[model samples]
Structure formats: structure tokens, C-alpha cells
Target: MDPKPSARVRSRTGRALLGAIALTALLAGCTATGTPSPSEVPHATTPSPTASDAPPASDELVAADADRPLEAIDAYALCRAQTYAFYPGDFALLEYAPFDEASVLLRGDGLWFVYIEVDDGNRPADLVESGASNCIVGGTIGEPKWELFGVVTRGEDVVDDYDAPLPSA
Candidate 1:
């Protein structure tokens, strides 16, 4: 029998086969020209693009209804933005409590309190290990003269509290 192929040659052939299989899998839904096949092309449901397809203008976002007891989502966004202004670091909002009708009655129209809980994803490893991963932002809807921010050990139990706006960058 002819001498068997060298181990190096066999290994090369195996690697080539694996690469070809991976390439085939990656391009399976495409045509021979490497473009997506007709069936793979997504059909547009609308005849033309809509306004929402584009990013909302900053003015548009700022112009959202300012009434108290806003939709839960709107309140959440307001609180999240306020929180970001304070933190300015990578964090995710964990929860939010929007002022309610009773709150409006006690405070006033357009005067709503939002408590936003956030997870500080960019905290140092030491802080993370020490369970300092969460914080809270408490403020009114339209930039109150003052706001409360702090890291908490237990639910709503603010530990190191701060009452001033973060220095502008």
C-alpha cells in the first residue's frame, strides 16, 4: 500500500474540511453570488418609511407631556435621565416608582416625585465584591432645585446620601 499521508498533511486536510463546513453554514441562506436569496429577503410591510424609523429629536423628547402621574414608562424615563445626570456612569435602571394621583394632590400639578433604583455596572471590582452595586435617585419631574442620591444597603435605606447636582462636565 502507498505510504499513509503524514500527520501534518492529515491535520491540514481536517482543518480545511472544518473551515469549509463552517463557511457553508455561515452562508447557507445566501445565493451563489453571496447575496441573500429571494426567500431570505425581508418584505417591507409599509410602502414607505415612517417617522418613528428615525431617531426622535431632542426637542421632541423634551416636549413630552409634563403632567404629573404620567404613564409609568414616561415617568421611568424621566427618572432614568435624572439619575444619569447624577451618575454619568454606566448603570441600568432596576425599578422606578412614579408619583400617583394622591401625590399630585399633596404636591401639585407637574410636581411629581420619581424614585429610580439603578445598578452601577461600572463600579470597581472591590465595590462590587462589597455589595455596593445598587443606588437610588429621588427627584421631581422637571429638575427640582435639589435631589437625593445615594448608595443603599437595604431597600430604600440610603446609606451615603448626597443632596447636590453632580458637577457639570
Candidate 2:
């Protein structure tokens, strides 16, 4: 049989446990058990490319209907696929309405942003986490003819406002 822990050792161990518990609570937001709750830890988002791909020697965005938001989403997808390795299959999101929240982080910047939720080729079996990730596409909204400002987030984690803007001319 081993000897019992000394009073000093017990105190140190208890202090360590308390410290760990405090850290867990701090990070986990509100949890009765001091564990990581689902909402506490926001899901991670797919990362975006650092630099944007330049337009194909043209400033005009070719589309059947420039007024249709779907067309712009398609353009965004097309542009994003070129830079991001994981893509092409995320087409279903083309129908979703754009979530405009681009300038929140970069206030005073005249550019407006549009966001779309992406389906990153995850099979039905792979969706264990069941979290949503949105992509950021920025441009001059309300312009008669809109040009693709850039692909910001390809369904990546957005901060105050998605910071990643893959600017293409």
C-alpha cells in the first residue's frame, strides 16, 4: 500500500482542479457541469484564400440577368471554386437569399456584402455536428450592373463581419 497524500500535496491538487474548472466555465459560457456546451463553442468555418483571383481580363461580370441575385451567387461560386480546393458541389446554396452584413467590421467602407450558406460536400452521414457556415460576397449593392467585388468566406466562420474578402477585379 502507498502512503496517503500529504496535506500540502492535497492543497496543490485541489487548487489545480479549481483552476481547471474556472477555465472551463469561462470558455464554455454557461454550463452547470462546467463543460463545453454546444452553443458555447461556435463551430469552425471553412477558411478562405488569402489573395483573390483577378478577373478574366475583363471588368464586366457576364450573366444572363444581372438583376437576379442567383446569378451573382453563381458567379461567386465559380470564382470561389477557382481558389478554394474544396468546392463545386456546394451548388444548392444558389437559391438561398443573400445575408448582407459585410461592413459591420469595416465600418465607413462603402462596399456592401452578401452572404450565403454553403453545403461543403458533406454527406448525410458526415453532418454529426449540425452547424451552419456562411460565405461572404462583397460588392456595390443596388448598382444597375454589379461586378463581383470578391469572394470573402466560402462558408467560413464570420467574426463581427466576415473579414476575408477575396477581391477580384
Candidate 3:
């Protein structure tokens, strides 16, 4: 015999070697996968508007003689007043009007005012009788032409008041 080894000793050694190799392979596989479980995964998200969002759209500059009535207060001017009077940030323009042959007055914040004259070639009448505060003013001037005087804001302050009218000409 040449220092013969027992079968029990050989079997134990083999099992230990196999166990170490299996553990190493398991660790390697985990690293290679590099994926999180469903519980660990994050959910989808929506983007929120930040302070640096694009500037609000400007009001349409139209001719005074066009089918649309003359807007005593423009969107830009309204936005400035809103900023001075209320919040400061991005905002949307809602509505503006002379609409038909109607006279409508908008007033708020000490320095801001809007007065529209919708005339049928005679005296102006107040005809902006219906519509939400935050929308476009839709109607014709003298003829039946449709126009859109969209809304505007300085941030969150609304400029939709008929309490105090601007000076009449």
C-alpha cells in the first residue's frame, strides 16, 4: 500500500470543494444580472412645471378697425398688473372681450383697468354677458366675424372684474 486514503475522507473533501464552487457561482450570477426585484423597482413619474417654464403666450395684436372690437386692455398689460398685484410666476390668459357691440369694463388692483366699446356705429352697449373668466372672448365686432381674445395671467391673479370700469372716451 502507498499510504492509501480512506473513502470517507475523499468524499468529504470533494463535497466541500463542490459547495465552495456553487456558492461562488451564485454570487457571480447575482452581480451579472444587475436587476432589481419588482418590490425594489421604482414607479414611473410625471414631469412637473418648474419656475423656469416658458413665458406665457402674448395676446394677438389686431387692428382696431378689424372685425374684432378694440380691447382696451391687452394680455401683456394684464399679466404685468397681475404680477404687481398678486402672485409672481407663469400664468395663463383666460379671456378678453368687446365681443359684439357691447361695452364691458374690467377693473382690479389699483393700477389695472380694461374698458371695451362694442358699438353698432352709435353708442356702445355692454354685451360680454356670458363666458368663463379663464377663456377666449369669441364674437364679432360690427359684422358676424368670429374672433378669439384669449386669457392671460401674471401668475395666479385673475383679471376678470366688471366692478370698476376704465375711463370712457
Candidate 4:
């Protein structure tokens, strides 16, 4: 004859086993869910650089100068004159009238610098004729050791307005 388990013990063991299985299934179900939806997800936005992000330079372009209304001129005529000044190589000049502003890249002493010129409405008549400076307000170059002697006029006249040595690049 074999000894049999009591009905109460067997029932208790069955309930315990079922409870354990249910708990395991519940935990697995929670883990099986996918990532949260867009509305529920946490995210971060990165800020972008703006014009006012950096302090303006000492010789920064004047707002009034930029806002000065420009007059249109013939691109072909301006190109011919700029080509002559920057001879033996192709030079790109903005195709706008009155030569209000310009950005130039010049090489000297085996280094490059970015030069910016703004019209101050005091442009010389000769420069106006050649379409170099309609009205030069301010000009600056980015070369610490390099000094901008002045722009060479059509007749080689050097206009010495700002002569400080550029900051070292």
C-alpha cells in the first residue's frame, strides 16, 4: 500500500504553482510592451546659433550702412573693372549696384585673409567711376600681422582710412 498526499496539501500546492505562473506571466507581459509613444516619450531640443550669438566686432558693419538703400548697376561693367584691378586671375565681385559692400579674399606673405568693405556714402568719384567703392564706410581684414595699407584705387592712389594691423589669424 502507498501513502497518498492529503487533499488540502495537494490543493495548496496547485494554487501556489498557479500563482507563481501567473506572476511570471504578468511580469513577462509588462516587459514585452514596446517603447513609449511620441507623446509619452521624453526628448530634448538643441538650440541653434543666431546672429546675436557672438559679440559684434569693434569694426562691425553698421546697421545703417546695411540698411542704406542700394541702387542697381550693370554687372558686366563692374566685372570688367574688378578684373583689371585683380589682374591675371579671375576675381568674383557681387553683382549689385553702388558697390555698397564686398567680401574679398586676398593673399599676402603666403597667408589668406578675409576683407570686408562697407560703403559709408563717402566714396570718391574716381572709385565710383571704376565701381570699386561707391561709398566706403568701413573695411576690415582678418590677419593679425597683416596691415591693410588701403585699397589701391584705379590710379593706384592708396586710401589710408583704417591702417591698424589685422589681428593674428
- TM-score per model over all chains: 0.29, 0.25, 0.19, 0.19
Better of 2 and 4 by TM-score: 2
CA deviation > 4 Å runs, candidate 2: 1-86, 90-107, 121-124, 127-157, 162-169
Encode model 2's per-residue lDDT on 1-169: one tens digit a residue.
6599866677678879999998876776766686766767757596654446533312134332344443344534433443343333456432322334222232233332334343444435464233233333334322222323333443345444444444565
In candidate 4, the residue pairs with backbone N, CA or C atoms under 3 Å apart (3 or more residues apart, or in different chains) clash, namely: 118-137, 119-135, 119-137, 120-135, 120-136, 120-137, 144-166, 144-167, 144-168
lDDT of candidates 1 onward, in order: 0.44, 0.43, 0.37, 0.37
Which 10-residue window in model 2 sums to the lowest lDDT? 101-110
Better of 3 and 4 by lDDT: 4
Q: In model 3, what are the clashing residue pairs, if there are any?
A: 93-151, 93-152, 94-135, 94-151, 94-152, 95-151, 102-125, 103-125, 103-126
Best by lDDT: 1
Query: What does candidate 2 score in Cα RMSD to the true structure?
Result: 24.6
Ten contiguous residues with the weakest lDDT in model 4 = 134-143
lDDT of 1 by residue, 48-108 (tens): 8577786665444555633233444444454455446444465553323333411111123
Clashes, model 4: 9
| RMSD value for candidate 1 | 16.9
Query: Model 3 scores what on Cα lDDT?
Result: 0.37
Writing each residue's lDDT as its tens digit, candidate 3 over 1-169 gives 7596666567667879999999887566453368756665547596766657744322212334336542534432333332332222223422333334223333342232333221122212342232222322222333322222332332222333433343355
Superior by TM-score: candidate 1 or candidate 4: 1
Who wins the TM-score comparison?
A: 1
Clashes of 2: 0
